[model samples]
Target: EPEVTQTPSHQVTQMGQEVILRCVPISNHLYFYWYRQILGQKVEFLVSFYNNEISEKSEIFDDQFSVERPDGSNFTLKIRSTKLEDSAMYFCASSGGLVVFQETQYFGPGTRLLVL
Candidate 1:
């Protein structure tokens, strides 16, 4: 029974400050992704990474954002500058199956961020 886990279940930050969300997924999974859900808004895709490189990213993943696999065991999403609009729940997911067939992504418990 493997699972994806996130750290700092919650975070509070000032506008314009930097923030990093962290996650660790099942050991054998290959693909990883980041998504966010703004309060009262639908979940939005931010980025996807594989083979030590980014595979896909949404428009929301702009110059202010970056993703990394620092030690081959943890994945992180860093926001260079926070904004009021950036307050939301961030999720991390991993899939062992291939994307061509719509593999199921196992999601971590979200990290809730609040910006003031």
Candidate 2:
């Protein structure tokens, strides 16, 4: 079965630097989303995209953050300016259908981002 994949399972960066996290969503999936979780916090939705435009976004998705489908299979998240508070487990998910039971977002293990 196809699965989502993320690169550099962990990332370390200096504050104020640009960081791009890479993800390869499941093949044939149409919807994509990005979420983050602080060490002990709930998973928070950042943004969801479909048809090349953002479908929905949470308040956490500020100007410093942006997402792109650079290619047919690759989805990327870029943080223009990293902050210490931005550190968290970033997850990439994709789904082929709309119904929650029939098509649930498949998540990657995660990319742990750390800023210091």
Candidate 3:
């Protein structure tokens, strides 16, 4: 079995700085996504990518945020400018198929971002 992995499990940065969260999804998966959860809050979808382009995204994925798969196996999320309110646990996920039953997304442990 394979699994998604994230790097730098935790990160701290000053407001206005740029940050990049990295993830490696299970081999052979086709869809990739990013989601965030504030402490005590429900997980919120950020963006979804497939076929090398953005398939869908939420309002939260404003100009300040971007995502890329620089390498076929690694996906990354970049925040242009960090804000105190942007602090949250970011998760990277991937799904191999879209069937109702197999469309489940497997998530990485998460990368905690703290902005000051």
Candidate 4:
């Protein structure tokens, strides 16, 4: 089975700076998701995309965040401005089932983001 992969395994950014995290999901997957986990906290859902449109998003996915499929295979998340609170491990995932919520999700290793 194919798996999701992410780039720039670790990142350090200044507060108020922009950052873009990239991912390549399983080629056949139809649903892609972004999640984050802050230190000592549970994983938090950020957004989901399907058919090139946003299917769902959490409250934390405010105006500063954006998702895109720039080409056929790459999916990306951009933070317009980072904050101290935004530091975390960001995960990229993909689900291939017809009903996404019920399918098994394949997750990437994750990108660790730090704000200073």
Better of 1 and 4 by TM-score: 4
User: In model 1, what lDDT does residue 95 have?
Assistant: 92
List the candidate numbers ranked by TM-score, top first.
Answer: 4, 1, 3, 2
**What tens-digit string does per-residue lDDT give for candidate 2 at 1-116?**
78899987999999999999999999888999999999999999999989898889999999999999988999999999999999999999999876644778899989999999
TM-score of each: 0.96, 0.95, 0.96, 0.97
RMSD (Cα, Å) of model 1? 1.0
Q: How far in Å is the alpha carbon of 109 misplaced in model 2?
A: 1.0
**Which candidate number would show the highest TM-score if scored against the true structure?**
4
* Pairs that collide, model 4: none
The better-scoring model by TM-score among 1 and 2 is: 1
Residues 9-108, model 1: lDDT tens digits: 9999999999999999778899999999998999999999999999999999999999999997999999999999999999999999665348889999
Clashes of each: 0, 0, 0, 0
State the lDDT of candidate 4 residue by residue for 1-116, as single tens digits: 57799998999999999999999999989999999999999999999999999999999999999999999999999999999999999999998979766899889999999999
Runs of candidate 4 with Cα error greater than 4 angstroms are none
* Model 3 alpha-carbon drift over 4 Å, by segment: 98-102
> Which one wins on lDDT?
4
